[model samples]
Target: MINFESQNLICRFRGIVLQSILWNNDVKSTKYTIKEMIAHHSCLELPEGKSITKADTLEDLAQLYELDDYYWAVKNIHPLTHDLNYVL
Candidate 1:
């Protein structure tokens, strides 16, 4: 299970910076290690504008674009194969 304790998630992935729009950093720590963080949210979002949560993976992230919770996030994603509604 995720720790749920508060944390500061900073993304410096491959030297690319990620500034979370919603201040996701200060929220609860879903995972404990930098490796874990990279494998999920910060790293992916910085480069691809896509991130995963405890309930999702990179593949799962694709499906999220169709959901209201993640639809807005697709605004910054270019070269998308689908339309605004994502239709994934």
Candidate 2:
């Protein structure tokens, strides 16, 4: 379980530089990590938008993870081929 303080810190950090840092540092490995994270949490929802500040809790983080996976999956696979396993 994520503690409240840790969650807040995550939200703040992501809101500031999560995307920039992730995409800027080693795109291939970052994408792989995102894909794996989403695959591991196959039941999570993927919310729209580019802001990582959207995650307010562990549940929200799951959704954000899914969104990142979906974003990369769409780029790498046919839309029809991409599994909708996590869609709400």
Candidate 3:
């Protein structure tokens, strides 16, 4: 993990890309990933304090969105978005 030490903090979404998926299934299966931006809320943790000790009390807030299904989660993976799951 990379560590940063700066009082003047700045963070931005570098955006997400399908990095690499060598092995997905338990038997190590390769599958073509289809990613489309479905309209929904996506919560991201604004960069935390320089050290872990200065973090907030609720870690849940970081992953919790206002409404999005949070596609990253296992249960929510297939149904990427809740109401609006279709590709635009």
Candidate 4:
């Protein structure tokens, strides 16, 4: 059970990392950590757009983009397949 939990955590972390890479590349302007990107997405603001000071809480973050939640939901897949998963 612990192993399974660890694997899940790894998968989720990897997924976040891959998603951060994609988001960074998609914008091609500012580079953001996974946390920052998640927060930005939660605020419904582009990384290159105006700064958001309201996404301080996880619930506040949750209201930004429905897509972000979707992204986090499957963040544990292989990195090579992230592009395909992200498109769907």
lDDT assessment of candidate 2: 0.41
Candidate 2: TM-score? Answer: 0.27
lDDT of 3 by residue, 24-48 (tens): 1211111111111111112122222
**Pairs that collide, model 1:** none
Give one digit per residue, the lDDT tens place, for model 2 in 1-88.
9678646644643433345232333334443444344445432254322222344332243345444553455435543333333342
Deviation (Å) of 16 in candidate 4 = 0.2
Off by over 4 Å in 1: 1-6, 10-59, 62-68, 72-88
**Going through the candidates in order, what is the number of backbone clashes in each?**
0, 0, 0, 2
Runs off by more than 4 Å, candidate 3: 1-60, 64-71, 80-82
lDDT of 4 by residue, 1-88 (tens): 5477546643553554345444433322222443465354343254422322344422223233334554445444434453544453
- TM-score rank, highest first? 4, 2, 1, 3
Shift in Å, residue 22, candidate 3: 26
**Which scores better on TM-score, 3 or 4?**
4
User: Which candidate would rank higher by lDDT, 1 or 2?
Assistant: 2
TM-score for every candidate vs. truth? 0.17, 0.27, 0.14, 0.28
**Candidate 4: where are CA atoms >4 Å away?**
25-88
Q: Against the true structure, what is every candidate's RMSD?
A: 11.9, 13.1, 14.5, 14.1
